[model samples]
Target chain A: MLRFIDARCMLGERCIIREGDPNTKEAILELMDRCHIEKAIVYHAMARESELPAGNMALIGETAGDDRFIRQWCALPSYFGEYMSAEDFFDAMKQHHVTSMRLLPKTCGYSLRPHSIGKLMDLAAQCHMPVFIDLGTELTTDESYDLCKMYPEVDLVFGNSGYRENRRLGPILEQCPNFYLGTGNYVAHCGIKLFCEYYGAERLIFDTGLPTGSATAAVSLIGYAEISDEEKALIAHGNIERLLGEVRL
Target chain B: MDFRELVYGQKPFEGVFVFDVHGHIGFEQGSQLGPNDGESMVHTMDRMGVDGICVSFSPGIRGAWKRGNDQTKDTCKRLPGRVFGYAVPNPFHAECDLTPYFEEDLGFRGVKIHGNIQGETPENDPRYAHAFELANRLKLPVLFHAWMPYEVDRAADVASRYPDLNVIIGHGGLTFARDRAVAACKRYDNVFCDTAISSAPDGSIEWLVDKVGVEKVLYGSDMSFFDCIHTLGKLALAKLSDTDKEKILGLNAKKIFDL
Candidate 1:
């Protein structure tokens, strides 16, 4: 089954515009049309920064109804009970057919610094789900890598990778297993080579934002990428399929 | 993963000898290197299909000398062939200027100083000017971390006096804010703009390439951290000829640094 995931590179709770970017729903359909992506996992800033995870919850709930896509919610583990109790989180996921969770510990100013939300994270792992976050910042790389290494059972994906810092990843990925990558910030120059060389194709997934840089443009280089077809399939479809396969959405 | 192979068949990148004028390695935060380092950066060169790079350490002085030096130095020692070095000279460090930066540092080819941009300088400090002259005599290109519109005069003065020296104005001088990079490049032939931070302010890289010619524009992923991808990738969207693309990517820095 060929499928595409909307990695949600950028979304404004309010409208912020890139010259060629499309709106949320339209962007996804265009991305699917362009790349033959049948399914996409969506992320949004409005949901992420909500006073409650309610915004994220609502989006997931709405999208879960669509067979063409899966809804992923942002869980502020640090702000847990306040935003939504763990029970509410479960309820929302179950209610909306939410398949996964995305975390933004740094941007949300939450402390993934060992001292905060230990139990909550452990509980999420018990539920068996994936956590996707934008690791575009410097600190998040170490933290994400370290955290994944620490919690081998937990599945994590880092989007908006620091392209130039691709070299630093080999050691980190070598140390941290069970980690995956989403490319919203990938460029043509040596980006595919770097990702394939160091991280292995098993971990790379196509998650570029739609419309503005829809899968057509986003996956163009990816389609022409030199990695093996099986490997490319994993990046293009398989890995993400397996990622969702684990969750009961 | 040779650069030629990666960029092959890519028509928009037809320019010969595109110089990655503003390449960097080394960490930025609190690690042995801060955020990104040379070793960590090498793979990206292959990924971006970059032919070669003139590397610098990560951004900010690490708030400590021992840490900062190690971060910058380690990149030079390890990736001599794959990368070039730029010393982060904090001129305020009264005792040590960029002298050792000239000699003894074998692999390192140039020097970069970031002042006030990190809340460190008053822009007109004499000692900073001394560092500029040191780079001049050493034939090392200097990338200073001071913005324009506010500090245009400072950049202009340095470039005019050291017309023979290659002084790149880091960060597009407000990316063509009030001082405007195009006007600045026109004013001083010796001065170049590091596109790392300049980027497409109003019209994208097309405007910069149009205004200053690709030779004066260089690619910088400032500390690179997470921002380098977008910084360098912006060029891909530019509507320049292939020859121009090569110049902006690596050849310009090659010509300037004589690499």
Candidate 2:
């Protein structure tokens, strides 16, 4: 059996949507078990609409004793010292053992363009860390393209990209090697096969957008794809694993 | 079972009997995509191990209701046991008669109403009353293309009016429509939601089962437009017990459509 790692999951109650269950660590672990995911990289759902430090702390507290989870900190712009300076932020990540980072520029009041987040992007690039941005929420395709160009050394993964965004994503894949796609809601027919054929499996990572998306659906896309087992392994866990291993923290 | 076996093995879904409640047949100019003919649909079904499908004609739903219905009947005739027809009635065209299609020999198992495509007719629109009445009279389940909460509410309204009619909210009311879709099922005994494109926010399937009981949820793959394997995999790998999985996979659909 191929070991699976979910690249995206949330760990707290979402403020806006009160429809589903609260995403506590126990709930996520049970979900991972249900979908046969071996490990997950999780951030707190509160980060999408709350203070970054508090949300990150909540995430740290929730997964303090759990090894199955890899903590991802929600980052904010360092304007007026709202978040820490780039250096301090990196140190905090090391201290907290956070392997990945996510940015909600729109909800958190910032922009992906260098003018707003340039220093942070530079720090991320220097540290060889992965930064995740969600499509339709934090950034648009063009904005993601600009960020990828600005920080070639920083690995940027775009999450929550559905079928409608594929046509727009093709140019980014062609232009930016540092740019990657999170396959949580990627529902295009034969999308995994086509993605691997065009951009290589290393640029695609497995993510379920869990607690808000289907892990099995994401897994089935890669598992049942016409790609080879080696490619499946890379997309399923190896690619994200390689990125996490390269994290300076 | 191994992941590979569950997905790509010879009998990919060996033990489960999958009955897809939402499917489309024949091509539509608007979508400009489909292997929508019967043979292509069956070919895909065989590949995915879909035991059966309750299908409507895409062109029929778009505009050519009668021609599309005739084409669906022919397709169902071509593949009797596998392809079950859903009669599409254009409420805008009152001349559109659905009576003959529901007859015993015609083999239509249900009715499909698209409010979005059919000029956004509310479910309570008097023009649709005839079709709903026919469905109630024939004991056929009605599948409504519900994309919003209001659409689901309209379905609940019509369902309440015709107590015997089984109303299925297609796509599980999709996107922002999920909460209301669940409420509709909880409110009406005859209302059920199909798991077609509802594979979002992780535990939604388990949540739905928990809220409304497994019996109120049915497995539907918006196939040809969407992948059957994707929806099937969602249900197959959900956290529900095997009994619940069995019901969502085929049992509920089998009981609802009498297939």
Best by lDDT: 2
**Global lDDT of each candidate:** 0.59, 0.80
Off by over 4 Å in 2: A16-22, B1-11, B25-44, B66-80, B99-107, B173-183, B186-189
> Could you give candidate 2's per-residue lDDT for residues B93-118 as a string of tens digits?
86988999876666689999887877
Q: Encode model 1's per-residue lDDT on A1-249: one tens digit a residue.
A: 334455544343534543333555655465365445667777555765554355675575556456766677777663433666656676677777777877766656776644664554665677767777677552456677777766677777777664444555667778777777776555524466557876688878787644334344345445545466677677877888787787743
For candidate 2, the docking band is acceptable
Candidate 1 is scored at a TM of 0.60
- The TM-score of the first chain in every model comes to 0.85, 0.95
lDDT of 2: 0.80
**Which DockQ values do the candidates obtain, in the order shown?**
0.07, 0.31
lDDT of 2 by residue, A1-249 (tens): 666899888878676654554365676677677666999899987776666778888888888888998999888878776778877888888898988889888888777778877888888887789999898877788788988888888999999876656667888999999999988777654567668887899999899887777777777767766688899999989999999888775
